[model samples]
Target: MIPIDFKGKRLVLFGAGRVARLMFSRFPELNVVAFADNDSAKHGTFVGKVPVVQPEALRHLEYDLVVISTGWWESITAQLQALGVAPSRIVLPPKNMLAINNGEKPFSHAPTKALALEVLGCVADFSARHAIPIMLDFGTLLGAVRDGDLIPWDDDIDFSLNDHAYPLFVNHLADLKVALPKPAGCDLDMTVLEAEDLITGVAVTYRNAVGCNAIVPFEIGFMRRVIENGQSVTKGAGPSFIAPEVHFHNVGSITFLGKQFCTPDDALGYLSYVYGDWKTPRQDVTLAEYPMQESEYLETSRTLV
Candidate 1:
C-alpha cells in the first residue's frame, strides 16, 4: 500500500503530464496549489485546466506538498531539492503503483477501472433521484462501450442529456459528488464545476488523467444536434442509437467500474460510428480517419458462429 492520504496539504505538481492530471481523480482531497513543468513548450500551458509554470515561478507561489508526476520521479525529486523544495514537502506515488500502458512512455498509476465506473454510477443515481436523464457523451461514451473503460490519453468524463431533461438537472442537482470508494481497488469522489450554467449544460469531469486513476477530463454535452451532422442533425428527444451509430443492444446495462450502468440501445454500434479503431488505445496522438469498424455484437457473433 502507498499509504494514500493528502490531508492539510497544498500541493504543487511537477511535470504537467498524465500523472499530474490523474492526481485529482485518485486523490480529490489533495489541495493542489499549482502545477510546474520543465517543458519550455508547456510553460504557459494548463493541466486539468490549471496553469503550468516553470521552476523559478514556484518562488512566487505558495505550496506545501510537491509531487513528481512523471516516470523520472527520482530525478525530479532531487531537482526540486536542489531548488530548495524540502524533501518532506515532496511526495511520490508508490513505486508499485507506477506503471506503463500500451506504447506510452509515462509511468502513471495503474488503471483503476472501478474508480471511473463508480463515479458514473453516482451520476446515474443523481439523475434518477432528480428525474434528469443523462447519457454518456463523446469520448467517455466511446471508451466505455468500446474499450469497457476510459480512453488512456483522453482526459475527462462526458455526458449528454435530452434537451428537455437538461432543465431538470439545471433546476435540480445541487452538486456532483464523484463517487470514489476507499480501499485500494478504486478511489472516487465528487466535485461539481464552480458556477454551473443551464444552457451550456453542466460539464462533469470524472477521469483523473492517467491510466487507472483516469485522464484529465471534463464531462459535458446534451442531445439535439447543431449543423455538424449535415445541417439535418438537430436536437430532439431522441430514442438514442439512431443518429450517431445504431446501438442494437437497446437501452440497457453494461458492467463498468464493477457496476452496471445504462448504455445506448446499441452501445457497441454507437462506438463504431464514432471511433472506427476502438480496440487500440490512442495515447497522446491521432490516427488517420478510416472506415467504421464492426461493433461488439457483430464481432461477437462472428466468434460465436
Candidate 2:
C-alpha cells in the first residue's frame, strides 16, 4: 500500500513514462491533477486522460504532493527541490511497485532476489580474493541480521567499503566486471562509480544484450573515518550520520543467504543508532522519518544509507 494518504488530496505525477502509467492504472482513485514531464515532446501528450505538461506546469497546478513516477527519481527530486517543493510533499516510489501489498510483508520479487544474490556472491568472492574489506550496510544489513534473508520489499542490495578498500575496488573494477556471472542475454556492468561530497558509491547493473529486461542494481558506499572536535567519527558519502567510529571498526561477519558476509562489529548498536526500533517491521516509513541524532558536523546529517 502507498504510504501516503491520498483521500481528498490532489497529486501531480512527475513523469509520463511506463511507471506513471502503472501508477495511474493501479490507483485510479488518486486525484492526479496533471502529469509533469521534462521532455518537451510529451508536453502536449496525454497519459490516459491526464494531460502531460512541462514540469513548469507544476507552478500552476494545485496539488498536495508530487509523486516521482520514474526510475530517475533522484534527478527528478532535485528538479522538484529547485522548484521549491517541500521535501515533506514529495513521495518516492514504493520499494517494489508491482509487488506492493496492503501493508503486509510482500513476497520478494523472485527474479530480483535471485539476480541480487548472484551478484552479491560474485562480489563477495572477489573482495575476499583481493583482501578488500566490504560489509553489508543499510537495509541489506537490517535484512541479514533481523530476517536472515533479503528484506522482502527491498529492491536492491547495499554494501559499504572503507577508504582503503574503495581505491582498490575502483582500481579492479574491470576485473570485477569480468568475474561477475551474467544472466542469459545480459552482461554485467560495473563501470558506473560515483563520488560526490555528499555521497561516494558504485552501482552494479545488468546491460541487456537482447530484449531482456534489466535486473536489480546494488550499491556500494564508501565510508571514511574522520577527526572532528578531537574525536573519531565515521561518515559515508551519503546521508549517514557522523557516528562514533567504534561501531564501524573491527568488522565482523554474519550469515546472510546461507553465506558469510561482513558487517559492522557492533551490528545491533549500529542499527539502533540509525533506526530507533530496528526490530519492528514498518514498510510505510521513509528514511527521513527515522529517528535522528544531533550531529555537530551537519545539521541534516542524521539519516542512514
- Reference-based lDDT, residue 10, model 2: 86
Runs with alpha carbons beyond 4 Å of true place in candidate 1: 1-115, 175-198, 205-253, 285-305
What TM-score would you give candidate 2 relative to the actual structure?
A: 0.63
**Which model scores highest in TM-score?**
2
* Number of the predicted model whose lDDT against the real structure is largest: 2
For candidate 2, lDDT tens digit of each residue in 198-282? 3345555554566665543333333444445533344532333344567655788887665668887788987887776999976
Clashing pairs in 2: 198-237, 199-237
Off by over 4 Å in 2: 1-9, 12-60, 66-107, 195-199, 207-210, 213-242, 290-305
lDDT per residue as tens, model 1, 1-305: 12334467777878776545765545556677778888788888776657889988877788877777654555676788888888888876542222222223221234444444556677777765665556675567777766766765454456665445556665554454322234342223333322112243343333343345443223333343222332212232211222442342134456665554555556666566656566666543211132212122110010100
